[model samples]
Target: MSVSEIEKYGKINNMYKVFLDIDESSESNVKPMLTNIASKWLELPNGFLASNTMDGDEIYIPNLHMINLVIGN
Candidate 1:
């Protein structure tokens, strides 16, 4: 899903979860791959929401107060 869509409706109990499912034997490559994926997501439009992984998937969710505070000013 696009970052915006994910941000709009991609949370469980107010947190985003991402998972990296590489084999435990391939642990060395996981960090760099995840970092690249994160960078690509950051390049998406309206992609400022914090992102993280759980169990091998990436999740994105809105930052409510941050958005409100920015908009309120």
Candidate 2:
């Protein structure tokens, strides 16, 4: 992972390192999926930090839309 200096502005100013390890077959597709997720409206019913799976290759997102996208639903 490359270290990036924190920028003073933007929604992600507080950096969170997320490691994604989808299947090799899906690896190349993950970025696009993530891009779509970023563009879509997301839900934070459990708050931002509580939204994701903390330790799995599958990303934890509070929004059902993103979760379904990641899980190939």
Candidate 3:
């Protein structure tokens, strides 16, 4: 599904919005990855909500390359 489709789903379900911070060169895998995530959301222990840090505290470490799934209403 397209990003707008995902956004519309989120709006209807009050679920989430996906934000990608990836370079153009890495665009090839974006759609499949998003589809996988959307399909697996309910299987996640924490459901749709998430955070960048485990304890809700900022990580002071610099230059960290991480993929965070933060679902917001």
Best by TM-score: 1
Q: Weakest 10 consecutive residues, lDDT, candidate 2?
A: 64-73
lDDT of 2 by residue, 1-73 (tens): 2223333335544444433345667656654555434443233442222224333333334433223222222
Judging by lDDT against the true structure, name the best candidate. 3
Candidate 3: minimum summed lDDT over ten consecutive residues — where?
41-50
Task: List where candidate 3 sits over 4 angstroms from the true fold.
Answer: 1-19, 40-73
Better of 1 and 2 by lDDT: 2
lDDT of each: 0.33, 0.38, 0.39
Residue pairs in steric clash, candidate 3? none
* Tens digits of per-residue lDDT for model 3, 6-69: 3433544544444545556666665456444332222244223222344443323343222244
Local distance difference test, candidate 3: 0.39
